[model samples]
Target chain A: MSGDLTARSGGLTLPRIGDRALWSFVGRRIGHAVLVLFCVATVSFFLVRISGDPVRQMLPPDATAAQETALRAQLGLDQPLLGQYVSYMTGLLHLDLGQSLFFHRPAFDVIAERLPATVTLAAGALVVVLVVAIPAGVVSALRRGTATDTTVMAAVLVGQSAPAFFVGILLILVFAVNLQMLPASGMGGIENLVLPAVTLGLYSIAMVARLLRSSLVDVLGEDYIRTARAKGLTGWRIVTAHGLRNASLPVVTVVGLEIGNLLGGAILTEQVFAWPGVGRLTVEAVTYRDYPLMQATVMFLATVFVVVNLLVDLSYAALDPRVRLS
Target chain B: MPVLEVNDLHAEFRLDTGTVRAVNGVSFSVEPGQTLAVVGESGSGKTATALSILRLHPTPPCVYTGGEIVAGGRDLLTLPEREMRQVRGNEIAMIFQDPMTSLNPVKTVGAQIVESLRRHRSLPRGEARARAVEALREVGIAHPEARAGQYPHQLSGGMRQRVMIAMALACRPKLLIADEPTTALDVTVQAQIMELMADLQDRFGMAIVLITHDLGVVAQVADKVLVMYAGRPVEAAGADDLFERPRMPYTRALLESMPRPDVPGGAVLDPIRGAPPNLLDLPSGCAFHPRCGFARPECASTVPALEEKAPGHAAACVLTDDDLPGTSEGRRVSGT
Candidate 1:
């Protein structure tokens, strides 16, 4: 008989999907997601209604009343509010948001067209956040109160304090303008993606680093850390194997929350870089009073937000045993 | 030779507000297969001394000012951290006060044991897992294979501690320092854990440095007992000797406070009069003098050195058996 307690197993073993408990849990979450989406759809529909006449806004000021009337009648805006709501809800049943005023294609189609670029930017930015933030945070926590920790914290502060648009502009000036290493603005190839992704990710990287460092600092003080040390594990091993799992609970929460924000079209960065992503489409849709496109973008973002948060909850249960999915 | 020898150990915490000398000149030794219980109040530095041997204190604030923790023919106090890592869990292992929070919640109990086994042994992954399961079974956890996969929260507190013991003993270190190991458990579970440790000791024959504030625990398993007061060893003797003839005033007070059936019917469970002395600014001489019932002016002025009043028994108080006429001394000390 040995003293080895073999106290815990690391990765989660997924219970069979055929299991009734897991299926019910997923079913309940989907139900909640649907409820949330319905509420969001209802709100965005009405909120869009108040943003002034989409038909009138689309027409030129000098256009005749007959022209305005023709546009309204064609777009079905001449119908009563309740009739409009009923038709809109009916359209939703067929999975149709009306045609984009500007794009002249189905509104969902227009938003979906711009989605890949937005997803690319968001994905690149997320990679940047993880690659830069986690290591810096780990180092800062391990070297706490030393110059290394102080420096990382100070740099994180600068990243957090800097405005996204401002950081974007600075990156453009350095890499695209003066250095002439990449394009200053406008989307083209992977090179153009770099500056914008970095600029967009800067703030989140700082946020994650600061959060991870502090979370880890607290975890390091726990009795388990001493237990790990007494087990004769190296400091680095303990941090990675033991401390990180517990410390990362909050970090996972912050990053999960950040993913939703990033995916919802980084407007300022899109505008600065002229990236032609959904964020830019969102702006054009709003400025041109493209109601269908506007409704589509908001719904899409809301869906992404809801789904991502649900995944985050599931991930929490996966990482921590105490948080049960049921 | 003793399995572990600590000589003139001094450890202090350098907080923002002045230095607090937590363990002051504590000296002791434990023979192989023997148990030396270091009993003390909260601030009495019993925990610090145990932690110091492992160099487990967080370095900046917790500095071992001067000491020698001799083990495996080297002074552990001065060993490089890399070498110290080898000595820890291999030569000497330690279990902490809280079992509930001591094990990582995310990892399964089996994995924690596997980690400890792999740290010192160059076993294959499958072999380490087998060893871990075997260790859990040794600790009396039923269905050890299934229990190894469970998390700490899945087990009872008594079960968690048994897991802790399994992990600490997996490497079979020469000494195990159990710092208040049973304080967080229920009375029945506490007895079970203590008995488990004794049973393990009988099998492996490792020395135990039991740090506790419970006299009851000390009496149960300790072969030799060292009672600490104000961060210093106030009394040291065999458990039987110290229980019968506690030479120091503080040790006398500790035994009196015990609720034993052997005591007279009306004996007062006299609590020590004052709180333990502040380690930051310990009083002029003998740290416990302020609270001693028979404090002479000399007890306040001159710090008393621990000296043997009888063979194999020593205490640090100024008075001898001669100072108190009727106090030989258990009968009068127990009156509340």
Candidate 2:
């Protein structure tokens, strides 16, 4: 026991993550993400087919029976359901999301064209949420029980409880209709991105802020915080240096979940703002019964969400040293 | 002149239901290089008094009703907050009871020490870090460089306490307030930590205010002992004097209650009667009167002042020295 004690305390250095161990951890997480994506593709491919016959929706109501049969055969929709699923999976291996019926182009190409817009909106909203929420949270926590804290918290509650479509409409009414300071819809300059991003990001902002406030409040009560104060650290230093990092653990989890929500599709926000993103594109595909495009979009979202959650886990390990990656 | 003087300090916690008076009119002084142990049971206001000196208690709930904490020729209560920041770690440092929770879990122990150094000293990062390693070495932690890079969870309880001591003493403050510094460690480790504190006090020549509930800890290193009961000091005297010639009934009861191995095999230990009084609704007159075996009619009607029973010893009780039992007289005691 004494020898064990000496060994444990003998060389007290920062915990080192070996290159091999780190790679193994990353590899394992990546493998799990891939498995999740595959499952998503399988489920979505089978589920979309069950909705109805796509050939009937693809053609007009007055089209001839021969025309309908020819269309189904050409698109390979006439095959058995099991055969079609296997073929879809096989095509996915080659990264070919079969052609879009509406655009008469590969589904992947069509979706990729609009991917940049969704990415931009999601990234912009993320930036807005982080910039606004962190300071608000820290201040609310510091001035807890005061009028300032109550007002900020009330604002956050409104932001969280309000539906995305309602918030989008409100922003459009105030910024576009009343002031005419910005465009109401479409992808253009930074101004056009503002309303949609804020509408989609408001709930995320509220979530991050609430989580950060509660976490910081708990951290402030810790003995280490008192130690920091006793060490003559100013209030700002104590909050930023000693308090924020510890509080960030829970906030990071909330932020990661919000990112998944944004990337998967801010469907309602896109509709209200008329933003040209994958969310709007997915709605269009579902309306026309574009099975391949819908499947590809759902698969793409599932992959992004899985990868993002994996990164969140890695960050958790980084933020808290005691949490080791297995 | 005394290094730290606390005069008639009163601290209370205001809740929705009522106000709980934790420390009532407590007063004492510690000269340079002396160790004054404030001994009491749980919730007896010893810890409250220590936090009061540093003004670390939360304000709305924890209010200092009345008092003055004078140190380094200035009244701490009157000092502006900005200047008070300078005095906190520069002139008066503190180490808490549990070393486990007293450190930032996410930060390196070295970073914490360097934080204190750079906060008060204006030293660059590199210099502060070097000094941090040196501070760790001063506390007898082996592999100081390696230890400095580690987090608090990586170190043992004893080592963590040493780290706390190092952090407290890094600025060479004129006074150090240690609140139950060894309460969380094993007996053997406790002895080592206490010895380390004594050694550090000798080298730094900083007065220490040690707050503890354990009489054994007080006897080991305290030059002066202040016994508190129900949020007020009931007795104050030199360690040897208080141990051998306890005058207050409560103090005598406390001494008698301590389990001794050297007593004859069949001797039954006499535990003190009654629990400590509730601070929210304390009994009338003396707080300890209801528990005192020697309580008289007057003891319940009026509180007794802390009168000097010896040249330096004082106790707050209605009983005269001649009226108390003689069992504790002429007995020599030393803490293990």
**Candidate number with greatest DockQ:** 1
Q: What is each predicted model's overall lDDT from 0 to 1?
A: 0.87, 0.87
TM-score of 2: 0.95
The DockQ score of candidate 1 comes to 0.56
- Residue-by-residue lDDT tens digits, candidate 1, A213-255: 9999999999999999999999889999888989999899889
- lDDT of prediction 1: 0.87
Encode model 2's per-residue lDDT on B1-336: one tens digit a residue: 999999999989999989999989899999999999998778889999999898889898998899899998998987888998999988999999999999988877888888899889989877888898899999999988888878788899999999999999999999999999999999899999999999999999999999997777887898999999888989999988899888888878877777656655313568788898878888999888888888888888898888898899999987777898675753445563
Q: What is the TM-score of each candidate against the true structure?
A: 0.96, 0.95
Query: How displaced is residue B79 in candidate 1, in Å?
Result: 1.2
Which ten residues in a row are the worst by lDDT in model 1 chain B?
Answer: B327-336
lDDT by residue (A6-68, candidate 2, tens digit) is: 223212222346756667888998888878888999899989988777899878899999999
What tens-digit string does per-residue lDDT give for candidate 1 at B236-285?
A: 89988887788888888777666665556535576889888777889988
